[model samples]
Target chain A: MYPNDGFRELDRQECLRLLAKVPVGRIVHTRQALPAVLPVNFSLEEDGAVVLRTAAASELVRAVDGVVVAFEADEVDAATRSGWSVVVTGPAGVVTDPGEHERLVRTGPRSWVPWPQEVFVRIEPELVTGRALVGGRSLYGVRPPKWIPARR
Target chain B: MYPNDGFRELDRQECLRLLAKVPVGRIVHTRQALPAVLPVNFSLEEDGAVVLRTAAASELVRAVDGVVVAFEADEVDAATRSGWSVVVTGPAGVVTDPGEHERLVRTGPRSWVPWPQEVFVRIEPELVTGRALVGGRSLYGVRPPKWIPARR
Candidate 1:
């Protein structure tokens, strides 16, 4: 039992369950053909769609529309040094239907920033995968080194 | 004052400074032509390299070696609904030099899991970007919905 890797693969149900627990997650998309990470507050839809509202004019809204992107959310406990990370990879679409937009506006994620105009982006979870890091709490924390040389 | 967007852009030095404060970050890479994310505990080297050690046989080690990836870490204070997120984008290279590997062994990240054989992957910070979500603490938390339809 000890030799077994503590990295446990989670099932689809569990992955989505964990996804619903966190309010913030990083959205991974390509900007200028290179990966870019943006931390955004998100809401999980009933159909496993990861929905987030951003400013209408925000660069992310335009860049991610109809594009495949990855969303990740996780929680690591300090005392246990263990947690589960779930990644959802799928295509993102800006919610444009007035009816659907109204539904989301009434029961969607609270805005982290107030913007003049905002739009909803929904990411369909086409591929879901996650791992649980468990049973390693021996190391308390790394001592803060007095200094780290400026990398310039 | 409130007219300004709550998200204030951070400069390079400040971005690295925030990156150094967190031990855990998510590494975004491509798997099967689709983006994937993994939470890793990393250390900052003097040369601004983000280093993380993982099992030698891990798929990520092979998938990310010499490939461009994105690394992000952030801190959120539930108190003020404010925090900073920093992302570093660059190419990842596995430590092949014996001397460098040993050097990392002496002062690298403490493993959250006990892996028998681990390899260190170093990522250069080519493009560093970050933002501060400042001043929005009114809403305490989101209440959980009583039910959600399972997506099948």
Candidate 2:
């Protein structure tokens, strides 16, 4: 609802597009009753679910599974100070079905660590929100300067 | 404690240094009992508390005040797949003292939007943690390739 704030809200479609363009995002969850953030490279499933891998026994796995988490990804240009950011909030669940696990092994993001037997965690895109900040223009639409002709 | 994961844990000093190097980061908090993340341009105070400007009437101000929040910043090189990330978890508060507000207005980050009378929110750096992912080396200490001579 905010207008003329140098930022525009991105629709769900646009949010997903921006999210898919970036391989890394920060995950926000609770740790020890306090908020914690971790960066991970993630890949999106066909339905826009986020999938990432971590050690099967890692604390992150234990802390995030079946809990609500927020994931954010953004791309900004330092020179222009323009970019878009997307945040997805939803329940996080560890992939347990053997068939789904097998499919993920072949299609999901590979572990960045050398450790083996990584577990897959999927974050359902229940609440998706995004915003784009441009120095003076809209990310999806650009208008010519007033002095410039509309045609040509 | 977990080593050899292509990532290295960073100390508090290093985390602060990296955090100071970036102009923008994501702030994580709770909204309606669900996690939410928002990107904001922030400045660091002498004690490393994060100061960011937001609209005085913004929802973020209400949702985060008197609550623990998490802030994250990172620098990653897509080409080499190497980077460092830092997470700061602490209490968030709005600058209330007229003296502090006046001082912040002079030295803190200015509002990016064209809105007047912005508010300054400070997040204390309580539990600062960071990690660096340098493909084959540490961000703090770079080791020579095994084949390279020690003195070369």
Candidate 3:
């Protein structure tokens, strides 16, 4: 059972762990009527961000880039009474630059099995929040990235 | 490993089974520059349709009713080397009648965690497609509803 209190913030490590376990996630964006949510196969980048592929003409490709989008992944283990969810809200951009595209392509095997028309889009997270359900207790929290001082 | 030829078409029973196993699904719609997909917790109605709940102010609420929306749910079992997916494309509408709403609320417990602001939306499926990966083979196909004779 979740606590009656408000959702708690999650740490960076906890968020990353939750994101890694879920293979499919929901990408939320504003559409014509209300916000729309779609599921897609996703992978974690070296920097703990989310990456997914679609078609060049895919609606996903068009709405995500240069827009603020929310990506979420989660897993639930009923028998063990545990589950975790991680959400990344950030501005998304297309990776047209050869170097960045190559990096994403090589990070992992292509997981999406979409129709012939699909392209890839990646989300660079700005805010991350996660929650873990353990023994019927929910632990939730938000974590911001750490910043280091710039060297002169 | 799925067959080189791709996934196989699944039957109605298979589609329902696959749908029950997955917790998250994507609802795709066009509003922004491209199509938008969002993650949602859904329930299968008694009449063999999908049901979703959202707030009255939700953009989805405005766009879904009497609109063609695409709903997809899938599950992948890596260790077993098997997976299945089901896609429903059809017209959606709000269930405003009191009797229908009560029946849904009384149906088996809602799998989704409760949200304070919830409005129910129902999808009247027009076309259904499903695919399954089994024994290194991928099967795919579509199922349209049967036509009934008119009554005197």
Candidate 4:
């Protein structure tokens, strides 16, 4: 871990490795112009892609398939105030190849919800970034950001 | 919990209650038309607004202050494969009220990071939604979503 700032930027490879350590994450996609996030159970492949199973009727499948989205996961210790987060952003598409789809159906990440989640979405990572808060410090820098409310 | 689909929809009140139960969450915001998520430690007020502390120089501070963003938190039982998630969306602004800011600094949610973290960002929630998967069934539906690879 980086020592000075207590915050270290993780490289792409490190990000992927960290992702494999966790089974759950949040997927972020744009609804209109606002960003929406949904929790998902995902697995990382050897090639750095993320595979997730979701409900066919869920909003994520209807709107996010084939769209650019972001997947994020992290492990944090609240008491220690230390944790690392990895985010993968790329196009999320339905698994189309029959052979691969069959394999994923049997081996891909499992879902926790009971709804019929036949939809298998794969996020091909275009960019990966991560950061860790080390030294048990939750805040960074010498001071906190200024929050000034507007008089509207 | 909702009995049939093993999916239960939580109300706004319950969503806020759950937020208080977890000290960490992910904040989702749009940065230059791309969605970015960052893990943060936060606290909830009785009014349902969410408050957090961050460094002045952080990307979250620069990009999310006075912006509308989505904050999500969840806890899943790995063994049981059951969990719940809550998402809050609203406009985040710097606490301009001196009295509130001071109170938050003293009694508000504390940060794990050691930086001064004097900067307090408050997200006044416009929408709060949540869902829970109970009864421990990790896989959903009788049949998963259909996946077919494009023939290119």
Best by TM-score: 2
Q: Taking the true A–B contacts (Cα pairs closer than 8 Å), what share appears in each candidate?
A: 0.27, 0.25, 0.03, 0.25
Error of 2 at A4 (Å): 8.8
Error of 2 at B89 (Å): 1.5
DockQ of each: 0.21, 0.24, 0.08, 0.27
RMSD of each: 8.5, 7.5, 11.1, 6.2
Under the 3 Å rule for N, CA and C atoms, how many clashes does model 2 have?
Answer: 0
Pairs that clash in candidate 1: none
- Scored against the true structure, residue B137 in model 3 reaches a CA lDDT of 22
Where model 3 places Cα greater than 4 Å from the true spot, the runs are A1-13, A23-41, A53-70, A78-82, A89-94, A109-120, A127-129, A133-152, B1-5, B9-14, B20-42, B52-71, B79-81, B89-94, B111-120, B134-152
Residues A41-110 of candidate 3 have per-residue lDDT tens digits of 6788867777876556555565567887877666655444355657777787767877877776677426
Candidate 4 local Cα displacement, residue B8, angstroms: 0.4
**Tens-digit per-residue lDDT, B1-152, candidate 4:** 11133356789988888888998888888876677887777888888888888665555666788888988888876556567888888899878798988898897777554354456788888888887656432354442211111111
Instruction: Give stretches of model 1 more than 4 Å off.
Output: A1-5, A136-152, B1-6, B136-152
Predicted structure 3, TM vs. truth: 0.58
TM-score of each: 0.83, 0.86, 0.58, 0.82
Task: Give me the runs in candidate 2 sitting further than 4 Å from their true place.
Answer: A1-6, A137-152, B1-6, B137-152
lDDT of 3 by residue, B55-128 (tens): 54556666567787877776655444466657766777878888887787776225333444555778766666
**Candidate number with the higher DockQ (1 or 2):** 2
lDDT of 2 by residue, A1-152 (tens): 12334456799899998898887888888888888777778889878799987767777787789999998888865446677788888999999999999998899886554344667899999988877766544543553111000111
Expressed as tens digits, the lDDT of each residue in A1-152 for candidate 4 is 11133457789888988998887788888775677887667878888899987655555676678888988888987765567888898899988798998898788976543343466789998888887655421354553222111111
Worst 10 residues of 4 chain A by lDDT: A143-152
Model 2 interface DockQ: 0.24
Residue-wise C-alpha lDDT for candidate 1, range B1-152, written one tens digit per residue: 00123446688888889989877888888877888777778899876789988777777777789999988888875446678888888999989999999988999976655465777899998877777665534332332111111111
